[model samples]
Target: MMTDALTLLRTRKSPKVFDLAAPGPSPTELDQILAIASRVPDHGKLAPWRFIVFEGDGRARAGEIIAGVFVNDNPEADADRVAIERNRLMHAPLVVAVVSRADAHAKVPEWEQTLSGGAAATLVVLAAHALGYAATWLTQWYSYDPRVRAGLGLGEGERIIGFVHVGTLARPQEDRPRPPLADIVTRF
Candidate 1:
């Protein structure tokens, strides 16, 4: 079991979000994934993050907001571009927006708080993979757009760290090349 867990971590890879299909995690499975995702190293116990789940009709609503913002910002955008934005979240059975709410705290720096949020997002992907699902963590153009941000209900100092798209992998993916350990590692 220990070796299996290690192997899973070692070989984990995210498929393209577009390649993801339906039959996502059930409500209970999602609850478990979220619970596992929340267990991250948080200094001062400042859980400076929250999750916004987009599933079923919720995905369509979120996509519409994104598409609207894209068109508003880029009036010359073609129909294809607009449609892509509109269906961005539709490909995945579930998309969880990890919002970082790091703020000024005397006990914890804002950077550390933000890192904790990133850890949570990473865990979301890992947990989903462990449960036999494909997951991709992404932050597209909409994640930075002011109008889209406001439309998604983000408050001051809140940022979208990632949108974890989860579903079944439509096809197998080849392993990409990894950087040499000697080039990246050094013992100080």
Candidate 2:
């Protein structure tokens, strides 16, 4: 069991967002994924993160919001560029936007809460991989755009940690090179 877990962890890889195809996690699986993703460390018991799921027509709506923001920001952008922004979420069958709602807390620092949000997003990827799906966590320009944020109904205190794109891989992805432990690790 230990070896199996290790192997799953070692073999997990993030494919390019465009390489992710259709047939994402079913409704039940999505519920399981979100539940697993939420099981992260939270100091002060403050769950400072929430998820925004985009599927089917929702993805297109999000894309329109993104494209609108992009066009407003860059008037020189051509149709193709606008279309690319418009279809940003169409590549993946499902997208889960992890919003960090870190706020002022007497006992818990905002930084800790933010880290917990990041952990939640990371777990989303891991959970998808464990369930035989490909996922890539991304945060493009739209994530930080004020107009896009407003269109997406993000509150002033809330910020997007990432957009976890989950789907089936069109083809296998090769593992990228990792830094050697000797080069990075050190004894205290």
Root-mean-square deviation of each candidate, in angstroms? 0.8, 0.7
Write down the TM-score of every candidate: 0.98, 0.98
lDDT of each: 0.93, 0.94
Each candidate's number of clashing pairs is 0, 0
- Model 1 TM-score, all chains together: 0.98
Q: Which candidate leads in lDDT? A: 2
lDDT minimum window of 10 residues, candidate 2? 141-150
Report how far residue 156 has shifted in candidate 2, in Å.
0.9
- In the range 112-177, model 2's lDDT, one tens digit per residue, is 999999999999999999999999999988898877888998998799999999999999788899
Residue 96, candidate 1: C-alpha displacement in angstroms? 0.5
